[model samples]
Target: MSHFDIFIGEVTGTALLILLGGGVVAGVVLKRSKAHNAGWVAISLGWGFAVMVGAYLSSGVSGAHLNPAVTLGLAIEGGTKWSDVPLYIGSQMLGAMIGALLVWVVYMGQFKAHLTDPEILAAQPEKEGLVDQKAAPAAGPVLGVFSTGPEVRNALQNALTEIVATFVLVISILTQGLNNEGDGLGPLGVLITAFLVVGIGLSLGGPTGYAINPARDLGPRIVHALLPLPNKGGSDWGYAWIPVVAPLIGGALAGGYYNWVFA
Candidate 1:
């Protein structure tokens, strides 16, 4: 694919990925929505469908690497060129931010109602375990709709969770999802990958919400920090690096392992 095609494809695909993925969380969590409290099954399947839709839309154009971790793995696995890595990651981040912004737009009324509700505002800090106030609350009510956070505060465990989950995801893609040319996923691969995502979310998402994609987490978190949502607590900068760094480490290790053992 040409550079322009790669850029447009990644941006559009990643945007759709986050749009539907985050939209599900918003629909389930935000007040005044029909799907509010629809539960985890809906979330997991929504994200799975989100990945499938995004991948199918962009695979023919740029191999539909909607995640930076996948792009990094593809590059290391010799499917994607090193020179193109920056474009892939940058487009993914931009697309993620755009998708998050769209979610806020779509759920504007619900967000306003949820955040402005007197009971929610009063109970927020306590729910986030910030009453003692050692640092900023790591999460807020709607933050999960945009980004991820751990249910527990153990850094080592959280990092390991993200690393292992991401490792599984990248390795699965490397092993079974790549096309013949190694540039991207084929039709079957995309279907398998989408279900793989749902499985990961169902099996391993509890601890840290399974942020196997750096762009998926960070770009939306950046938007969360910037947006003027009432009572939206800190962006959890303290925990942000783990999701970003650990996934890259996992992706790189998957690539190296594929080269060493599977090649």
Candidate 2:
């Protein structure tokens, strides 16, 4: 595929990724929504499907590394050219940002309505009671927005989880692609990979939400911070570092391991 074709594919893939993944979060987290409280299983599987669609659409052109971690891992695996890695990652991140921005806009009305509702405020008795006594201030509206920052926890464990998840994803992709090299497994390979991704999310995503893609986590996290909302909280910059750093580490490690294992 030409560079332009690859670029278009990358952007489209990333946008689809954020639309599906972030959309699920908005569904579950937003108050009175249809998907609210559906929990992680729904989110994980939803993302898996998103990845499947994105990959199938773009894989022919750009190889569909919608995540920076995936792109970096592929470069290390020798499937991607080193010279193209930077551009691929940049496009992926931009695409992710665009996707997230769209989600923010789509949900803005709901968010605003929720924030201004007096009933919503009255419903939270613990918070309302504290505020009435002036012992605690009413929390800001941004509190409802989803975030990517890590909570206080073991940094090593968080990093380890990212590494393991990415490892599984990258390794599976490489192996499957290799197995189907001659037969041109095409879209079916993407579907199978998506299933693996969902499995990883369900089994191992508890710790850090399985942010195997750095762009997937950071891009949306950045959107949550930048978008105007009634009462947003801190972007959790301290914890944000973990997802960014860990996924790269995991991807690189997986790439290196793939090299060693197959060499």
lDDT (C-alpha, whole model) for all candidates: 0.90, 0.73
**Count of steric clashes across candidates, in order:** 0, 4
Q: Best candidate, TM-score-wise?
A: 1
Candidate 2 RMSD to the real structure: 4.7
Off by over 4 Å in 2: 116-152, 178-185
Please give the lDDT score for candidate 2. Answer: 0.73
TM-score of each: 0.96, 0.85
**Candidate 2 lDDT by residue in tens digits, 39-152:** 989888988988988888788778788877777777787877787787888888888888888877878877776756777656555544543333123223333234443322
**Compared with the true structure, what per-residue lDDT tens digits does model 1 show for residues 1-263?**
78998999999999999999999999999888999999988999999999999999999888888988888988898999899899999999999999999999999999999999988888886675643355446576788999988877788998999989999999999998475463578889999999999999999999999889999999999999999998887788888998999999899989899989898
Residue 73, model 2: lDDT of 72
True-structure RMSD, every candidate: 1.6, 4.7
lDDT: worst 10-residue window of model 1: 128-137
For model 1, which pairs clash? none
Q: Positional deviation of 55 in candidate 1, in angstroms?
A: 0.4
